[model samples]
Target: MEQEEALDWTIRTRDPDFRDWDAFTRWLEAAPGHAAAYDALMLADADLPALVPAEPLFAGTPANDRGAPASRWRWRWIGGGAIAAALVAALSIGMTNRADIYTVDTRPGEVRVIALDDGTRIEINGGSRLRLDHNDPRFAALDSGEASFTVTHDASDPFRVTVGDTVFEDAGTIFNIVRAGDATRIGVAEGEVIYNPDSDAISLPAGRALREDGRGLTIVSVAPESVASWRQGRLAYDNAPLADVTGDIARSLGIRIVGAPPLRFTGTILLDRDPQRFFARAAPLLGVTARHTRDGWILKERDGPQS
Candidate 1:
């Protein structure tokens, strides 16, 4: 009886002119499972017609034969079949949507490349976490770290990435995004993207980058090649702060760096297979010495002179 009422509500609510939303809300809130049952019926409404033939199910039934015992049994069987068909359809749709959620994570010194069902490709940098929903192929969430995306062209479903409160939407583009603490930096390599925050939306085209922090948003032009350079085992820094660069290196190498003297360096640093070797090469360039401890590498000021 409850299922029957739920099905009735589903049909009524689907009407184009249905306007008793408050009453419907009251009905749904009246019982705990009422809403779930109605939702099942709605899914069945979409899928049951495709799987079950209406002509064969209703064609031979006559309205005047309701008094006969066999006729009553036949009607019950048909009703049961319809409800069963709707339940099956609802379950199938639920499974399909839930199965499309894909999650991938990377450890330090590891990079992963994923080719999604929709032909979109994602390069997840070391120590990054990302979730992609194939049901909504163009939407994803970056929980932490950095990633580069080569989104397939699907005008119907533009690519969108959410990092905290900020959203980056692209029609079809190659872009890189990094999330560190409260700061987010997005760089576009190919095509364009729309950067949206609470206040406004900014259109960023190829060879441009945007950084958002406590102060505000800043836009700058960057070389396309400089974007996602970590894919080639190199990290390029152009006047980036010491804190930011060390943080990136630590994440990439899967190690910890502490006591880094405050100084900024500008150059490309090759990430060798050995984390110690990379640090040994990088430290002296900044006029610092690399000391290896149990925790990780520590950068200290060189005794001679500052670079």
Candidate 2:
């Protein structure tokens, strides 16, 4: 059959029961050259459908047999076909891979705000990566780490977020989900979110916090400012654990809290200033000592003078 006919057959054979499956398979495995030609065309068709359909297939088949000797011409055509196929396939593979990859990345100690095409806004936390498929209307997969999402309401189609094994249904709400250990910790700042606690619906209102603990949803009233403070350059804590407070400071200030543990603080500190001074001032009150490190701060128990 003509090369154009073969290509057309391949294009039309997207159906499984197209009866030409066997023929296509035969063509695919015919020879290294034949296989290469088929793969090149197939990859091009899959990768650049618009371009492939616009270009003519099998364009330069000689009209007369009087040109070169039959055997030499046939071998030359085979070599040409192989080269053409390899080039197309290579280009197609590269383009397809590049286009298909979705990367949500953040630098260490840097929170990045990204706006999605679908009107959803995402704030990726420092030292985190979230892979998302915006094209999938039913779901956006947060493949790793933590992010806060301000989902644009679309009732007809649910905007679902998948973090680890737990899936969150955006009830047209603004919420922050952090993947910690094996659980998905969630704090809702606006609207309402339905938590699937053991495959059941449990509603959490605004200013509420909960976590999927593998057992069920543990709900509690949370301090909204503390949860949303990362959006700003400040760390707000309301009677939070010393360890937890230090962790938050570490994430925001790009420092390490190494000391006699953390002293509980329930106030806000402007991070634009030296974080070391903040730690130094607070350490005595919390019975800890603040020491500046190369990239961050470390805390240890205070030994002597109180200043």
Instruction: Work out the TM-score per prediction.
Output: 0.64, 0.59
Deviation of model 2 at 293, angstroms: 3.7
Model 2: per-residue Cα lDDT at residue 69 = 37
Task: Estimate, for each residue in 1-307, the C-alpha lDDT of model 1 and write its tens digit.
Answer: 6665565565455444455656676777587456556654554455645644433355576755444333443354456676555655565566455444545556776677766668888888878888776467778889888899999977777778999898998857999998888889888999988898235768899999998889998898888888888888888866776777787787778787886677887888887878778877888876688888998788887887654
lDDT of 2 by residue, 1-307 (tens): 4343334443445333344444554554454334333434454554534433322234565544333233333443344465436445554564455433245545456676766667888888765667655355345666545688888888887677777777778777888877645666778888777765348677877888876656866777877655666777666655544665565566556555563364455566556446657766666655576777774577766667745
Which regions of candidate 1 deviate over 4 angstroms? 1-100, 197-199, 303-307
Clashing pairs in 2: 258-299, 259-299, 259-300
**Model 2 misplaced stretches (Cα beyond 4 Å):** 1-101, 143-145, 212-217, 258-265, 281-287, 294-296, 301-307
**Residue 104 Cα positional deviation in candidate 1, in Å, after optimal superposition:** 1.5
Error of 2 at 30 (Å): 45
**How much RMSD separates candidate 1 from the native structure?**
18.0
